[model samples]
Target: MWIFGYGSLIWKVDFPFEEKILGFVKGFDRRFYQYSTDHRGTPENPGRTVTIIPAKEDSRVYGIAYKIRDSDIEDVVSHLDFREKDGYERKSVMFYPISSDQKPFEITIYIANQDNINYAGYADLKDIAKQVVKSVGPSGPNIDYVFNLADAMRTLFPSVKDNHLFELERNVSALLNESSIRKST
Candidate 1:
């Protein structure tokens, strides 16, 4: 079985995989529309996380696809189910590998759609940045999630443009810098 990861899973892989492929899934836009209560924030102040939203047919969300060993499928699924229990659900989608020799194939992805109870939906980038800057949970500060994801995407897919992600990263970084300067003054 193959699992597709576009967000934290791209950089934080706690599972074992036989093979990993750089690829993308079409017809979706990655957005910070999911509230992360358990991992990045508390119940009182949830931090936003990426959830794929339906977009134009040509839209592509670049990510990594991991091939799970047949023996590890059950264990990996159980672990992911608990890890993504906040709002995500597993769904099958076609993944297009970046390598020319690889063909597109069906793979599972965890997605938090609008219908999820923990979905934060849309918000201005500034508002999102402010929330992220102030939020922290068991996983660590919310800013780490945004910064790491933006950095990972840039490192893994240099030419791809993820405006929403990069914009949020910039907003959060600026906010943090301003806060640091204010404290120093």
Candidate 2:
């Protein structure tokens, strides 16, 4: 079985996988439209997190795809279920690897439902940035997730255009800088 990780999964894959491939899923755009009330924030203070939205044009989300061993399927799925307990569900997605010989294949992805209570969909960059700046939870700071994922994606697949993600990252970074300047003064 194959699993795709376009956000935190890119930087943190706790599951054991036999193979990991750098890939992109077409027809979806990664945006910070989900509220992270579990992983990076509490119920009262939700953080901004990435979720795929169906794009009108041919869009792509670049990330890592891991191939799970047949023996480890049950355990991996169980772990994923608990880890994604906030508001995500399994969805089949096609992944196209960076390798020349690799062909696009389907993999399961944990996508948050827009109707879920934690869904922070449709918020502009400024609002999302503000939420991310002040939120933190068991996993860590919301900003860290943004920075880490943005850094990872840029480092791994530099060609892929995740404008929404990069824009949010820029806004977050600017907010952080502003906060630092305020404290210094």
Candidate number of the best TM-score: 1
Off by over 4 Å in 2: none
| Residues 1-185 of candidate 1: C-alpha lDDT, one tens digit per residue | 99999999999999999999999999999999999999999999888889999999999999999999999999999999999998799999999999999999999999896787899999999999999999998999999999999999999999999999999999999999999999999
Task: Give the lowest summed-lDDT range of ten residues in model 1.
Answer: 110-119
Give model 2's clash tally.
0
Q: Cα deviation in Å at residue 110, candidate 2?
A: 1.0
60-108, model 2: which lDDT tens digit per residue?
Answer: 8888899999999999999999988778899997898989898899999
Error (Å) of candidate 1 at residue 120 is: 0.4
What lDDT is obtained when candidate 1 is compared to the true structure? 0.95
Candidate 2 pairs with clashing backbones: none
Give the range of the ten consecutive residues with the poorest summed lDDT in model 2: 53-62
Best by lDDT: 1
Under the 3 Å rule for N, CA and C atoms, how many clashes does model 1 have?
0
